[model samples]
Target: MEVPSSEELLQFLSSCLSQIKWRLKSNSKRRLEIDVLALCTGMRPVVMIDYGGKMPELQNRLLSLLELIREGLPVFKDLKVMVIEDMIYLINVRSLPKFVSSSLDSEPELFFIDLEQDPPKMVTQSKESNLGMQLRSIQKLFSSTFPLDDSNTDTTTVLDEANSSQTSLCIDLSCCLQDTKVTIPTLNGWLLDYPVVYLFGTDHIEEAIYNLSTKSLRLFKVLVCRNGTTEKDSHLEELTSAI
Candidate 1:
């Protein structure tokens, strides 16, 4: 994928900020938009935004902004927003390129935008400062969540590990906001594309199966069969063999 030049990215972000300012009625919401632009363009992997105890309001505002970005910007489609305590975290997985390319001991410079000034201003925080500590913490969290087994591996290998049959995957929906309702057509579509065997559970079995099957389909054509019931292991073995 081609990365955008700094100037091009800034111009696009400026336009987005202007539109957000014009559309959002609340000052706080507009400020959130500015913060988001700062972090995203700054290429910070994970940074926390203080919601000031107004999580519900900020979450709705953030979701609206994310939807807008998702529809208009293909580059940020993989961006994930997570709420933890009073802080809202914006994780740009694309930022990993800069980290992966740099020396292991090198500290990353942090960027922030000051919109109070004319034309907006980009501020760079040195790696020697306190922000560096926070940056380290952010990197630690990111690395823990998505561990890289080999530093020499390409970015695609780092992010896309679903192709490995031995990889045990855990689909955590709590970290994200997703529509749980599954239609018959959607299920049929999934069934047509891949070999999926449903594993019914005590609760939300369809949603569970949908999440697993859909994510699996994105990586490669592989059989996704989960067992939540008391079915015998022999039965599952036979089913896979038959397929």
Candidate 2:
């Protein structure tokens, strides 16, 4: 398989976004622009869209977009489309397992569409084991630094301990941040910068903390953005530069 150059990847994604926007304006008769957040793990691209409570309409549009992508971009033919509430996630199917395993706490209710089928069919899976997988991954990361007690092997108990000592763990890991070279991969390739953090509310703040605390050992870096005009604009600017 041929790997797409950074410029090629970016151009493809730009075309996809433009197509989505055209569809929205033509079908909905409104200029409703969805916010997009793009992330990449190595060469794999994950595109997240905030549908702004217009999920039903966006979901159908995204499904058509997925089909278009499969036909246009052979590199991303196996990309999976998922809708959880108002958020729509488009990621390569091969990357799904790793993405799901890295998620913390309550996993999003993932509804994956089988694009190969006629009209595409939705496949729903149980999210019950997501927490367990996340916890185990965390345990492995922390095992060398904070050895787990052999006697207390319960997952819940381990999670409670980690939560309680989150502050101390962060303090200890602060020194390593300076030495770590964290870069977020983009459609245009990797860019070295502080990680961009978006806080929607109190819930998002907690989620940010949990992720940073647990993943600090693995080159976790972040710059928090509130709703303030300056900060929000700066975050968008940073995203633009990164991409």
Candidate 3:
């Protein structure tokens, strides 16, 4: 989660400007990379994205561009804000690339691109932002991406065992817990307030059971039970009974 050096971000902005001008004539996909970077820069939120085979060239370009910014823009080093929009991938068990910074006030700001009508704002190179501020911001971003506890040895072992099984699957529960307690019931109610729940799983089922047993059932919702393997059967039952 390295914050783009002010010079780096600015160079990206410059490259984006070039693309924006060129793509204005033809339909272009900017939301994923350039536009994402633009929106992230404006909000001063940590930008997160994964590197993939398709974008090796772009990744290298971005890396080089960042080095350029480090040399060019000293102001970005201290800046304490940025925006990030990207996917997450677990390429390695121990190390991964991700932006992990907290929001300025513990409440991060994010903006999703509107591909239909609202377009990204145009940015031009300027000396308005302070280099130190930018760099600090980048540091904050890198700190955010810093690794959390790697003490899930048991979980990793379970996952490894599950992966070896034909039916076993490991669903990411890290995203579910705020402080380790799954706020599934409350979250379910929140979701019931919405029109749909596209993702469903055993954890949600566990939550539903908890809500029902507590006489505080949020709403009636369907939970899809994707087939589980023998290894998962025991864990699933434990999760099921815990609810």
For all candidates in order, the CA lDDT equals 0.41, 0.37, 0.30
TM-score of 2: 0.36
**Candidate 2 stretches greater than 4 Å from native:** 14-47, 51-53, 102-243
Candidate 1: C-alpha RMSD to true structure equals 25.1
Q: Which runs in model 1 stand beyond 4 Å of their true positions?
A: 1-30, 51-53, 96-141, 147-243
lDDT of 1 at 78: 53
Q: Which ten residues in a row have the lowest lDDT in candidate 2?
A: 183-192
Give a tens-digit lDDT track for model 2, residues 101-217: 333222443333222233333443243233223323432433333333445334334344544544211112222112222111110111111132121122234444454354423
Worst 10 residues of 3 by lDDT: 234-243
> What is the full ranking by lDDT, best candidate first?
1, 2, 3
Q: Could you give candidate 3's per-residue lDDT for residues 1-243 as a string of tens digits?
A: 555543355456466445434232122222233323333344312222333222434434444434443354543332221112122211111221122323232223222111111222222113222322332343343333333344423333333443353211111222223222223322231211223212212334544444345453244432322232354542211101011
- Listed in order, each prediction's TM-score against the native is 0.35, 0.36, 0.26
How displaced is residue 113 in candidate 3, in Å?
20
Kindly list the per-residue Cα lDDT of model 1 for residues 93-199, writing each as its tens digit.
Answer: 55643453341344443343222233334454343333334333433433444444535443233224423432121112122112222222222222122233222
